[model samples]
Target: MTPDSLSRRQLLTLTGSAAAAAALASLSLTGCSDRYKLRCQHQRTGEVYRELNIEIGSVITHSWIHSIELSRWTDIYRFDGETLMLTSTEFEAYGAGMPLDEGDVSVQDGQVVIENIDREFEAIRWIHSHRVDYRIGVDGDESLIDTDALPDLEPLELRPK
Candidate 1:
């Protein structure tokens, strides 16, 4: 055909290149193409984990009834695709193993609320208890862990997936 007209192979290549460029532009505009899922797993074995959809500002909370205090304790985390930020915490009562030196403390619904902690952690680990309630929550949706069924004192963690 004419010198200005693209051959079949050249046309196909151009179409593929344009499609790839559009896909990349879409990802750049949406601004979270590399988002990670919040994952919970058995720490030692690196198994038996669950992954939950997480956005840049997604909130993850882990709460449990403290065995010694027999009261509720909750930790609030924010996921940023690469790390988890400990944003706040709530303790029902002061007792063993509780933070007493933290700043920005207040009382919300009778629980001691500590905000603006703003600490980053690669993974958060905890022990599974047979005698207390344990749960993992994301954006108000919660899943209760069968802590009693897990091996006594089995370790578990939440990290970027």
Candidate 2:
């Protein structure tokens, strides 16, 4: 065959290769569009720290010490597949910045707790500090993130990916 033309077998092989490539491209572009994940990153510098595959109705909790009260406090979050919701907060003791005299109040696990806040947040940000002892918990597994290693200027954030 001439250089500009192909034999019958060569033409068929080339056509098959092109068709296979097209199918792979389409599958890659359309596959896993509904997959959900939780992305954690630095708010100021936009440095990603971690990405955890999550599902609907997942729970994420942040436990830290109150700067003023010097007592431990925990903020609970729930994933609705599209966004994160601040469901409630637990306090070892009622202190500054807490609703002591009003709103829903309850007790759980021998600690003073509140429930049913029902607030929706697009993302959560916190400036990590060595003193406050920031801890993030996904489901029942803790120690997924380390706050002390991150710098102060880069505040940590949690949002949907």
Candidate 3:
């Protein structure tokens, strides 16, 4: 092959290698968990939750609601899987501990049915102002919830540290 052709091939190979290395490095640093940026605001009090990364786990409420785990930079909370069924703004508001009435944030034919967005926005603001850290699992219990009590939500395959 000509020197020009060989040089071009080498450059292409080097570029490809660099890109692959960068991608791998980023993946290793970030991990496979789902990342979220949830902002909660309650009135003047507002908190921005950044870089929330959570692994797959079951979050069960009293009525067997399956909530997906969420995190702030420091604290963690869980939202019902149905919550994702809403819009991004709605999700953020809910993450902030705003009230979600059936008509405001529920799904109808797979679409977000939010009418009074202002109310939700206010609620989010209120939550952030309150300085409430989102929490996961049973109230006042660090132990894994009994599998029998939660027929829908399963126990953590791995024990909590």
Candidate that beats the other on TM-score, 1 or 3, i.e. the better one: 1
lDDT of 1 at 153: 70
lDDT, candidate 1, 1-161, per-residue tens: 32124434554466676764665566557654345676677898987657666777878888888767778889999887678999999988876676777658888889899998888999888887766778778877875434455556788888777
Measured by TM-score, how close is model 1 to the native structure?
0.73
Global lDDT of model 1: 0.74
Q: Each prediction's Cα lDDT score?
A: 0.74, 0.74, 0.30
**Residues 103-129, model 3: lDDT tens digits:** 445654433334433211111111111
lDDT of 2 at 44: 68
| TM-score for each of the candidates | 0.73, 0.72, 0.22
lDDT of 3: 0.30
Q: Show the colliding residue pairs in model 2.
A: none
Q: Residue 152 of candidate 2: its Cα lDDT? A: 60
Which ranges of candidate 3 are over 4 A from the true structure?
1-18, 30-35, 47-51, 54-161
* Cα lDDT, model 2, residue 84: 87
